[model samples]
Target chain A: MRTLVGNHGWATIAAPGNTGNVADFLVCRLIGSIFICFSAILSGCHAPLSANNSSRVEITYWRTLTGAAGEGQEELVRRFNNSQNEIHVHCEFQGSYSDLAAKLFTAAAAGAGPDVTQLGTFEILQFARAGLLVDLKPYFAGPEAINTKDWPGTISTAGEVEDGLYWLPFNVTVPVLYYNEDAFNAAGLLGPPTTWDDFYLYARKLTVRDDNGVVREAGVALWNITWPLISAIWSEGGKLTTRDYGHITLDDPVVLKVMTEFQTLVREGAALLPDEASGGHRAAFKNGRAAMILDSPAAFQEIFAQAIGFTPMVAAYPAGKNGKVYAPGGGGLVLWAKNPATNRAAAWRFLRFMLSAESLAYYSQQTGYAAFTESAQQVMTNDLKDSRFGVIHDGLRFVRGDFSINMSPSVRNAFDEAFQKIMVDLADVKTTLMEADAKAEHAIAERGI
Target chain B: MTRTSLKACGIRRRPRCIASQWRSNRSEWLTFGAFVAPNLVLFVTFTYWPIVYSLHLSFLEWDLIEPSAVWAGLGNYARILNNPQVWRVASNTLIYAASVVIVAQFLAFFLALLLNLKLRGQTIFRTLAFTPYIATTAAAALVWVLLLDSKLGPFSFIFARLGVEGPQWLARSGLALVAIILVGIWREIAFATVFFVAGLQGLPPECYEAAALDGATRRTMLWRLTVPLMSPVIFFLNVSGFIAAIKMFDIVAIMTKGGPVYPASSTYVYHLYKLAFRDFEAGAASAFAVLFLMVILVATIAQFRAGQKWVHYE
Candidate 1:
């Protein structure tokens, strides 16, 4: 006789005279199935090793650009791969800068990360200090050595920390004044403001009000982010931080003066401070709701595309009393130090290809990012003739790429809160700045940054 | 041996009887182990291990990329407690959770009552009411952003018709928090309503009829008969809703980003996220996680204790 027992469609046959043997068989089968499932799931976590069966060295390159710029980066990699048979590069798109940094940190902690990654200015210092990035000085003398002199001094040297060059500028940007020419024409203004004083006056003149005195068109819209505000502060002869990151000088008299003027602009209804959710300052400028905005040239493509019915134009940021000293913004490529020597060499070759003059020029033409190399700039002679791109390049002459205090998260958070209080809440500038300085100092001391 | 004879010789027969029982039940135990092994492994690997590791990390000074962690003891906790912004964040979290739970629960209960009535197009009403809950949160937040824009939003149009300007919903500190809370309530009401509808449907009609014979009005019947009978669902919703509200991050992240000013609309979890990811303060973030866990555990325990008096478990 045979007996069948089942639960949830799982069944086992039991011999009438030998039930114990049947039970053992059922148990063993069940356990074996579980192990099989577990093995399959774990196996799926990673790709089969070198499944391509090629002798070429495989390297992974993680990038943080999207849309047209992302496509440009992909094309550059494709060209590099086609140019060489010994190296096969797989380029992956990691989401935004912060997202890439987070993934890199986790991957590094686990002893696994991409061979090369595009790192932002904020991450280079921390990652370098932690000894996660490769020192490229050794690779500078190889057959694929890049001409460092062709790259801008400030930008190339910005990556140098503790006698090690860990980063190379890939995409560079600078803040420029974006304005509506029609609004300027209506206000009887010619060209962009040349001085901060003239800029304030132009803002007031360009502002339009309805019969009930409601502002229909704001004269200027402040980006309200730390990057653009750096220019205004520096133009006023203020320093956000010392070169060594030891002191946060946010409460200096020059900073107070600059911040006070910004507060006055917002308080007097000449400026609009739109938050990120309300499309930010870019959207305000694009929609013609605001006549002027200070933004990075990286926004040129999006702003122009969206600013329909208006002749959008770009100009150099207004000069302060001390003249034009602007901060350089954007990200750079850094090779991870954890890779094997062969992989590292291949990654270096890929980096050299990306930073080549032709590649840089092509990238800049495709994206609004400024070509940082002199050779790349020379290659793009005709593209630079456009006033919008030319104005962005003009700001590059006085770009300061030092690791300032704003690079520290604690200090940046403190300053951002202070800025919001002064600009949005109409708080007293002096007191707010002083409080922020103290808070930042305390946090810096505690964090030991 | 016969059962009476075995009982008389209990000590001698006990071992043989136990051996026979084990022989019969061994397969069942093995099968149970086989079924449970996979889930147990997963839970231990993913959930329990992370909790344990986070607790360990809370005592160290590490930036996450460093090869080794330095001993910090309670330094992370001390810094968190000393920071002034932390208190504001905690207050914001409390206000958000309380507002969402109280407002959403009441609105959900009211809608459930209306929907419980045999009204026309009830299925459509139920589906419409629950749509927001199923809709993607990030997408919904983007829509809310446009609807609340001070200059071009629909609300702005209405305010303009009344000879007034619409308040800057996301640009002002107080209004920003209110806007986030409103979105939270909107999404949460749908989930609570579905649960409430189910509970209402399952309620016994005999209780209400008995109350009516006892000269109870509809209001009294609802209060005395229905509420007690539905206490188990109510208890579940309250506990779960509060927990969900306290961890609210997506709407705040997408809509306000804890901004217009720092900590203006930031919640506890968002603050913790910034510390870990943005600030690179892994130890401090871990400490925050541990503290958050403790708070949740204590709050849940307190709720369960209080529920003994009100929750009906028939």
Candidate 2:
């Protein structure tokens, strides 16, 4: 008369009348295992215990910063906590950018998301559209609002969605060209390449090959992601998407020219894409396998650390046919709508504290990111004395952020795939762009954008 | 007057007996509920509810952030079908799954046969063979990528020594899929070998002795006697291996990322992931999941039916 199916399922069912058998033992073990699993899950789901002094407002802040940047964020929180008795902020590092986004979305669905999060600038629009973000307009109108005049227009405006600011630009990154000064000296070059034509000439002159025609040292390496590629496109006077964000303009001939120039480097063995196994393209440059690399200025400290034998030089992105536009890159802090009213206000207070002049200066100095506010710039210039930060801050005016769209993730993926096809598979450039353009259009339409 | 009194007493006593029985039944039911409640609650909360909710989601248009889902009926399904990428991913998945099953089973059986022999360090060999199965997939993929790297990898150096140029394993289109498949096989063969070893030990020695008396060669014995006797294990491996292959994600994600172009190495799960998380099309992803579930279900049932014909049991 046993009603339960044991560990072996049908075997336990068939031996129903046997009261003391192996099936009974197995059934007990199975139940024990299930309970163990349940305990583990429950333990994971337990909320972080609060400090019991309940008068102070408590709010959770999740961020994707890691390494030195992560430590800087923790320092900021420590400073803010020390400065105030009204709010208690709990800062947690939540892995990488994509990892944080997934957690945030899942938490938002359960209405247990953090009071604040640092997300990519483009994501502000997507989250705002989904109503997961607080508009912050009311805060702007309030007395304690963040000063818009102190912030860089590039940083401030990039966080806007439909005229409503959804995020406060915290740390900013602008793409820059990092070159080996020793390699340039050996190659008899005076300075870093300033234009596309100069880039090709330097790349050819700096490239060195072995007896087997294997490239011993490549002139440059381009990251496979969209930022470097977009920088190249904009430098060539091409736009990925039109002004209204309604359609893509990648199929234009200017983009074709940019693609061809990039491909020629790989084809001629002067430059290459990052090999997935050997870390990244920047790794090659740091290890002296490549003469130059294009990467974010935020990587300045890391590249310098790994540059061991050579002096790492930071310069503006190599200009192309039309002008010297760089890619605007960085993440920003956004308040979550899932937070309680008091916690949301606390989060707002924390954001302002993080963006203050001294705080921004400390953050930028520690993390190698650019200071976004005028006051922050003055502090960096006077206190930090890092001239490289000033160069990046000036480059911000000429850069444009990745086109803001609610469906930007899909668009970015489409472009990544197309870039891979051209660089790795050696597919026809024009055909791949056409295909990617169509694919992005379809994604946008399907997303109801 | 005495008979009437006795009948009334009997009727009252019967009613009391019935009430006592009801109370005993209630206590028994309570005990049963207490025993089953932990599992029942967990099953409904995690497993059963999510399945039912996901099914409901397949018919609606909802991004997880949206307050309410819009009724889309069969629109999500239509979009999945209309998009040409689904078919491409499906075809790649089929190739990957079939190849993994065939290659992994062959390698596992051969290794198990070798390990079954009377050799020194037998335990060490078995442990070494089973290690990769228990290893973290992300770490293993990273190691594999390093091993296959062209410029600085040992494999490339070995190839160069042999006067052969190594292909860019993660860069080239056709080779990238091959690289992923090789890693997939590496991860699976260990598990299959462990199962095969156990199955080989379970075979009765009498059969082998009888086959030897009949003057059968070792090869003949393995083919005629061992394989048929081990058919059930082989069949189990085939079925489970195919399911694992179809659901493969981490290795591809960590290694190739469905890359080098469209229709190259993207699997069904990877495509569905892009839809759900990256694109925020939960409805379409749900529809895709429903289709994926049906596929695995049908394939599993078919394998069982096919097993009945070919699988041998004593």
Candidate 3:
């Protein structure tokens, strides 16, 4: 067409004679046609481009993870930001576990909260019930909001309420018995105690006292049980709460039996009150003060810290007399102070980053929180799995649901209070629990919890 | 010419003085407001704002996470004021405070007098005595804990050698409170001792010489002459000691942590700490804090009124 225009230009110049010189005319036509055609195509593509636009979204995530895992968490965030072009996340480490909860709550009330937080298991239920979380359905759209296929059952199942999913376990672990091998061998014990009866008898055999009447080494602590005391009740076929969420089933016969047995251990001085000198049970086991101690598998780092002194043996959460096994442990990630727009978005982004396989493995090795996802546990970059924490992934298998997770903290605080009294006051187990049950019931009613 | 100028200056002096007085009256207003504004602003910000906020919060049922605090009139206060734990904690606070102040001050004052006698290693002893106060509470508490250990600590070893069994300092229910109190007193009395030493040194030598001429012994001089003259410093110590003791938190947290089987170790501040900070029960904790403030106010005013008898201002 350009060449034809050029050929005709000489005739048309003024006589409608062909336009201009042939080469010059061809150049103008070619340039004009090319610009017009491409401009039309660009205009037509605008709608779809706008529909599939990629704009940066930010999420401000607050976490309580400190110590070693804190380092890995920052790495995960950095990688996540680098991996995605459309989103950037900023994660801040607020102090310890309890400190972050308080800060998040205060920020929430002030309407200045972060988008996400790594909350402890017990704290999640309380905060979630306060209507402080974004329903995953809105952000994620369905029950498969997060890919739940690789997640352990108890870890994910507990968070799905009738309306929405409240929490997700990014890093999860269950408590397991850790024994100092050197101490066990010295005591002539064949292996770590597997059952309560065996544990009690082994505890007595391990007991040793200095001439001063103060215990040189306690076998186990009856008084201190952050999780196992509750686990003990669950193990003996007792439930912490009823289906109605009102009854204190602590008065059940099986729970009483365990309590009585625990009391007997206390009376015999086989178990002891955790002393400051012992630096808690973890330290107790490390220092040879106690041969056996029970705590979260998250404590594997501390076990690692004690690598010079003792070799820790991690076993399954022991099964009880009724053959009912319970892991009175669980943990999950929560979005805190994420009450509003910008912070919440950023928090969600960072949370998603933590859920990714690489990020989870990176964080798992840093903190002792075992990966609830199979992808994470299989390939840890930290080379620490051969230590005590490697058992954490399998240990999460024992976690069972008890609705007591939703009980108000007043009840939990009261139970701890009552438990301490029953332990130190030397009260009869049935009589003490009956009183505690009554007290707890009254407290629940009084608060209408 | 000089006589006339002097007469003129005398006549000018009266009217000029009156004029300057009016000018200075405007400056007085400026000076007064300038002096008070800074303090008033700080008080309104840090003190009044928090109190007002907490008072409003006392009516709410909101946790820390909620966007808005839910109003729950009289509910939080009723829950707390009705509970017997409140009273127990209050009484425990009084006991903890009184025991710490009274026992610690007595020991500190006596030790200060002993150290002021120009002994061979008075400087070393003074530095060593106050060293505990300089240490972090957790570190000091940890050290004491290790020192008191029944199995490993030398204290128990010595006690055992003496044919007496030592108490479980932190583990036993009955002994836990005593153990923490001892820790508080030991760490705190060091500072008090140094202060007492300064006050003893400041006492007029004339009083001692007068007592000596009158045939009084050292004990007599301490009871009559020194005590009377040093009463002002002692009064200051007592007031400050009372305030510090009631605020006991670090000792209990580091050593006992409100435990050894009971909540009685939960002093007012510690309980308030656990609720407001730990449990996120802001409204309930605020009410408790306000009530505690009132109790402390009453005790303080009563102390000032009663001090006229025992405290010699002169």
TM-score of 3: 0.83
Q: Which regions of candidate 3 are displaced past 4 Å?
A: A1-58, A142-144, A160-162, A209-214, A276-278, A307-309, A321-324, A328-330, A337-339, A342-346, A380-390, A401-403, B1-39, B59-78, B159-166
lDDT of each: 0.85, 0.80, 0.70
Return whichever of 1 and 2 wins on lDDT.
Answer: 1
Q: Candidate 2: which stretches are off by over 4 Å? A: A1-49, A275-277, A382-387, A405-407, B1-25, B162-165
Interface RMSD of 1: 2.2
Candidate order by decreasing TM-score:
1, 2, 3
Taking all chains together, each candidate's TM-score versus the true structure is 0.93, 0.88, 0.83
Taking all chains together, the TM-score of candidate 2 against the true structure is 0.88
lDDT of 3 by residue, B5-51 (tens): 87887743344575676564544444444455556766998999999
Residue-level lDDT for A334 in candidate 3 = 67
Could you tell me the lDDT of residue B69 within candidate 2? 88
DockQ for every model comes to 0.57, 0.25, 0.16
User: On a 0 to 100 scale, what is the lDDT of residue A380 in model 1?
Assistant: 97
Candidate 2 Cα deviation (angstroms), residue A77:
0.7
Candidate 2 residues A1-449, lDDT tens each?
Answer: 35554443655444635544444454566567777987888887664437556688888889987878899999999999999788888998888787788788788888878888898754666788878898888998898887878665455667667767787777788788899999999999999988888988899999988767767789998786767778777888887875345877667788777887777888888887765555778778888889999888678778877786999888877787778776677678899997677677788899889889989889888888888678988887764455566667777777664444323755666677777778777778899888888887886776634
Angstrom error at residue A45, model 3: 42
Write one digit per residue (lDDT tens) for candidate 2, span B181-250: 8998898899999999999999999999999999999999999999999999999999999999999989
